[model samples]
Target: MERLSLTLALGDYEHTRDLATGQVPVQGVSLNVLTLAPEEAFFRFTFFREWEVSEMSMGKYVSLRSQEDKGITAIPVFPSRVFRQSMIYVREGGKIDRPEQLKGKRIGIPEWAQTAVIYSRGYLTHQAKVPLGSVEWVQAGVNQAGRVEKVKPKLPEGVRLRPEPQHSLNDMLLAGDIDAVLSARPPRGFGSGIRRLFPDYEAVEAAYFRETGIFPIMHVIVIKTDVLERHPWLAMSFYKAFEEAKRRSVERLSDITASHAPLAWLAPYTERMKNLFGEDFWPYGLEKNRTTLQAFVDFAFEQGVCHRRLELEELFPKQVLTSFKV
Candidate 1:
């Protein structure tokens, strides 16, 4: 039987490398994989649908899904998961030394709908007890000028967000124009005089996980709706292949005989993560990730990234949601 041919655009990550390199194969599908930077892949696929399958920003996906845009549907495969507590940046000698101090401050973000910013704002709102409306929001590129939001979000009442296309967030933060910056990528000024709001972020993130049980999701794998309609089983095939690839990456991370990653004490760190997050530290699928997914959708809605709240069940194809047990 001839296999279904598909193209997948994804970031270069250890977890998905096997699948991208063809070591792992999607059942009944021939994949032509393109490895690109996350920003490039997301922009191309989100705007033009350049590929049949792509890694998408969770905030952007939920925004589109909530608006009932049926251009694409996702499998439960998550290519990126990150904790955003460390993503917040504050200027040296800034007044905002604590989370509560964020009130009435100007915070710069790459986009209001950015996945990382959504999670960061969620933490501020729910965990830090800071009301979203209390702070003035500034939108701009992280390090460069003229960046614009990719999707239109329904801003919640009292939430003030304005775009500064002429200046980057990095420049604004350094110049004291914005009190702080929330972003996934560090600003260009991060090392010089800017520092994380939580300087000891690893402990803070671990504590947050213990309290909230959310290892915030950054990206999800999406397939064009038309392709899924023609081949309904494609979802499960893709899910299974991604699962296997992730499993291998986990195994490599846990291997103590030799280093699978360049970092020192990787094995010990992996073990620590397992102890904190359970054996399947980095998990895929709806049920396994329900807490994180549910929290994200709720945040997306409250932050105006999503037009309405999205249910966990509505996020992925049903095929990837369940499987036949042997």
Candidate 2:
């Protein structure tokens, strides 16, 4: 049989390294991997359906899925995971010193439904006791002016979100127009005056993980519905290839002498990550990740990003949901 040829658009992640280079091959298929910046990929794929397969924002995916727009469906493959404690940027000597201090203040976000903002606000409202209704929310680009929300937002009842079409969050923060920012990207010209709200954010994030067991998910892999409908087996094949590629990537990094990571103590850090997380710290599939996935569903619905809460089985194909093993 002729191998199925497909295009996959994704970020240049360490895990996807082998697949990108063709060192890892998908079973019975040929892949054309297009490495794109995260912002570009998310926007292009979301609006245009530009690629047959893509790495898309979990928040946006869930939002679209909730609306019953079934252009694409996802597998369990997550390409990006980030801890959002450090994503929030605040002015030094500002009124907001702690997460709770954000209450009743102005908080700027690139998008209210951004995955980073979802996790940040989830921790704040659920853990730090910041009431969702207390603060006024502002939406705009972090650095550039006139950034617009690509998808229509479902802002919750009593949530105050003011969209600034004319100014950037960077300028707003510097000018004291907003008290703090919940952004995944740093503001342009970010320096001394502006700093992380938690100076010891690493410790804060590690503790949050210890307590919550959530390494917040960002992007997920999706296949166009038409392609999947025609080639149903491709879902499991793609999952297996991604898993294998990630395994090779891990093996290469764990080899101490090769210096796969730039840090001097990288191997030790890898071991520590093993101890802290698991043998495979970054895991795909549903069972190992249900808690994290469930939290995201709850967060998206609470923040009004998704019109309806969705479960994993509803979001992904049945084949990738479980595998038949030897």
Candidate 3:
């Protein structure tokens, strides 16, 4: 029997860093691990940017998405914690009390970010009950000032919409051009910027329609269907390995934290990660997190991120799911 090779795509996140640094172990695997881009995981046998054509060329790819694109199997790799996306942030000295104060504040975010646009429109305006059209949205990217548009669902009548600006968001926020940012969790590198801008920073759950609908989906790991068919034992082995890794990850949380410093949202991040992983954070296939992943996929379809609702069974490795338990 030939040794297997698994190619993975990871994001620029801390947990991924832990995986790369060997702070976390894969456990019980001897396959060659190759790192690929966030998007190119689907293309096969493209080792180190070298393209090889074959039926099993791509091997197995695990990346981030609310769900896998059509024809691929997406396993819930990790449970993601939701955070705030706002326009104005108050530093050491500011008078902003709650969401209501956000009225008339200028906000900056990615124009095409579905999460930001949808959540702001649905959750913030409808649930928070902020004045309609109160947020002055400005479009900004890393290069060149951009344009803004209204993405919120329902707004109060007769509010004046300002001209969205073009500027780098961090630059604008630091320069006092934008009042807050409506985005996902701030990454570690940006932690200092967040602390400097909002020294009184706190993670507030946005008002969302959890009562009747699904929450937003962030990322999932997708496997090809054929791969599952060919390597029956591999899926179970991977799942078991990941489940153990997740367990180890939680058990050694203290060590992980000690090794990594200045993690402002450490407590909450760990708690959420633990919740998602449950007994294990790195479970490969069948974990309770699959339920949450299904809900997310359904919601993504409803919210238009995914074109249609994907069946959990169809999205996961069926062979592995039927056999694995944690």
TM-scores for candidates 1 onward, in order = 0.98, 0.98, 0.55
lDDT tens digits, residue span 1-326, model 1: 99999999999999998999999999999999999999999899989998899999998999999999989998888888888999999998777788989988899999999999999999999989989999999999999999999999899999999999999999999998999999899999888979999999988998999999999989999999999999999998999999999999999998999988889999999999899999998888889999999899989988889898788888888778777888
Sorted by lDDT, highest first, which candidate order results?
Answer: 1, 2, 3
Poorest stretch of ten by lDDT in candidate 3:
52-61
TM-score of 1: 0.98
| Segments in model 1 whose C-alpha atoms lie over 4 Å from true places | none
- Candidate 2 runs further than 4 Å off: none
lDDT of each prediction vs. the true structure? Answer: 0.92, 0.89, 0.45
Instruction: Report the candidate with higher lDDT, 1 versus 3.
Output: 1
Query: How well does model 3 score by local distance difference test?
Result: 0.45
Q: Arrange candidates by TM-score, highest first: which order?
A: 1, 2, 3
Can you give the lDDT of residue 48 in candidate 1?
95
Ten-residue stretch with the least lDDT total in model 2: 186-195
